[model samples]
Target: MQVTHAELVTSAVSPNQYPQDEIIEIALAGRSNVGKSSFINKMINRKGLARTSGQPGKTQTLNFYNINHQFRFVDVPGYGYARVAKTQRASWGKMIEKYLSQRENLQLVFLLMDFRHPPTELDIAMKEFVEELDIPYGIILTKSDKIKKSQWTRHLSLFKKDLDLPSVDALFPFSAESGEGSDLIWEIISDMIEA
Candidate 1:
């Protein structure tokens, strides 16, 4: 899990643009402004590598980040930003669905959700979509530092019920600011890669 080398490999809009080296890919998916960039930065133990932004829907491509020359972290475009044009949103949706469904090397997806609120409609839809695709995935409750320790159980229970998350799947409470749950997250990723 020691990340000796981590760098952005490419910003790809299609399958032809993706890295062709046969590297395993783990994707990050979430709503716009849900801290997907921060999750990648925290995972790689680097700041500004994934480009955290105040603007929603900033990532328009599948960003491939090479990790330890072993696998890649693919940062998919964030969804549910109202300001984007309808055609553009449709394009993004198509691109995301294509990549998730067709990519052979894609090992797993980390579905990030804000810990402060209930799972949005888009979040539930995404969960169902991934399930229908039969893709291995985990639910990451981000911004856990903003919540109280006593409320963690209640929040987790609510998320599980709302998302209809299976009991066997992984769920981690994370904080990019505090580095909480980073190790456990890495453990899960490492296990997936090794398996």
Candidate 2:
């Protein structure tokens, strides 16, 4: 979709604070430092729209960005940060679970993963959770420019084969630095909104 306008609407920690609109929401999910913020910034063609931090696990809230005022890009908090406390992590888990399982406006989830490696245990577990919840989602292979193309293909195949999610499209290689795959990602988002 042509991004005529994109702006941060709110940072929500609870469902009660989510935007009170039925607009379709496309959520971005990934581990800490997996380029989720970069992806959103690139997709919206707006620098600093999503905060990019050198420190992992800094995004501790559900960031909502209204796109064209038609739909929303929900940036879910990154998981599996080593420095985070166990109790904090558990709370994060519950928050994410509640949003994913019960959010009626959520239409699609873009699950980001590293391109150089196969899906990590956390990635696989998240995928399984989404499947069990019957949430529609797609895989996004972030930091593609960091890995060789051949290795990306191998890891992508491994992810699909191991997850038994062959019906879902192959990994979408993206690099916010290069703006690669930004258009394709936007196309997918538009399609979802239309559907």
Candidate 3:
């Protein structure tokens, strides 16, 4: 997609704070340190737009980025960060769950996972939770450049087996640093939005 304009529209902690326009929304969910901010920056073709950080769990709210003024990319808080207090984590979970279950304009969810390792328990649970909610979602395996090309098939197989990915769902291996899989990811997103 040609991103003529992209900017952070809001950082919302509650549904009332979300944009009230009729635009569609695409959400990104993953574990902490899964490079979600980097993914957002890369996809939008802008550096520092999503604020990549060294610290895990830095994104505490649902960051809404208006893309070309046509749709919004909602960066939900990352899960599975151990340093955060239990109460805080529980609150985050409830907030995320409520948004996922109740949002009507949410068209798709891109569930990010680390390509260098097997899917974590949180990742599996997230996949199941979204499916149970009847949310249309896909998996994006990030940091593909960190692994060898020959191992891609093995990693993909492991993900499918462990996650029990639905046949209708799609999975893409992505590398924010190398720009790999960016075009394909965009095509998928565009198709969903247009459909």
Candidate 4:
């Protein structure tokens, strides 16, 4: 992933607002503070390309990023924030569900989860939703740098057990700050793009 050109193409709220292109789309989804923006920044080798915020639930729309014009990285609104209004949350749910279930160009989804803790109830629900939609997905365990390297396998295995993962290959540890797992993630994305 030699990202020479990476820029935000659009911030969309609905399918009509989405980019009208046939390019393959790989979506990034996770909890409100799962560090998705940081992962994007590390993947594109840019600082602050996708805004990172200390505040949770800052991303309120689906942000599309064109990566060297090869494929689009669609970042949907983060979920599971407590302070967000219920009505706003409902709208986000509809927005995300519509995109995930209906988008034709969407190829794969990368579900980010914080590695420091077990999956929350909302996390389980999102995973189940994606599964029910029958969409291909990968699990990215974020912030692995906080955990000891020796414990990663154990942690990942626990996640596998908790999520009832179809395959261990479908998931991996990630550390956006240290750029860990970026290559593997890129490899997965590239495979999907080429497929």
Per-residue lDDT of 67-150 in model 3, one digit per residue for the tens? 998889999999999999999999999999999999998989999999999999999999999999988888999999999999
Global fold similarity of model 3 (TM-score): 0.97
Give the deviation of candidate 4 from the true structure as CA RMSD. 0.9
Which candidate, 1 or 2, has the higher lDDT?
Answer: 1
lDDT, residue 141, candidate 4: 90
Per-residue alpha-carbon lDDT of candidate 2 for residues 1-195, written as tens digits (9 for 90 to 100): 668888999998998999997988988899998999899888878889888999999989999999898898899989999999999999999999999999999988889998777778899999899989888888898888887776766776777787677644746889988988888887887778777
Relative to the true structure, candidate 4 reaches a TM of 0.97
Candidate 1, after superposition: displacement of residue 181 in Å? 0.5
Give the deviation of candidate 1 from the true structure as CA RMSD.
1.0
Residue 146 of model 1, lDDT score: 99
- Which pairs in model 3 have colliding backbones? none
TM-score list, all predictions: 0.97, 0.94, 0.97, 0.97
Report how far residue 71 has shifted in candidate 2, in Å.
1.0
Candidate 4's residue-wise lDDT over 138-160, tens digit each?
A: 88999999999998888888888
Model 1 segments more than 4 A misplaced = none
lDDT of each: 0.92, 0.87, 0.92, 0.91
After superposing candidate 4 on the true structure, give the runs of residues whose Cα lies further than 4 Å from its correct spot. Answer: none
Candidate 3 off by > 4 Å: 166-169
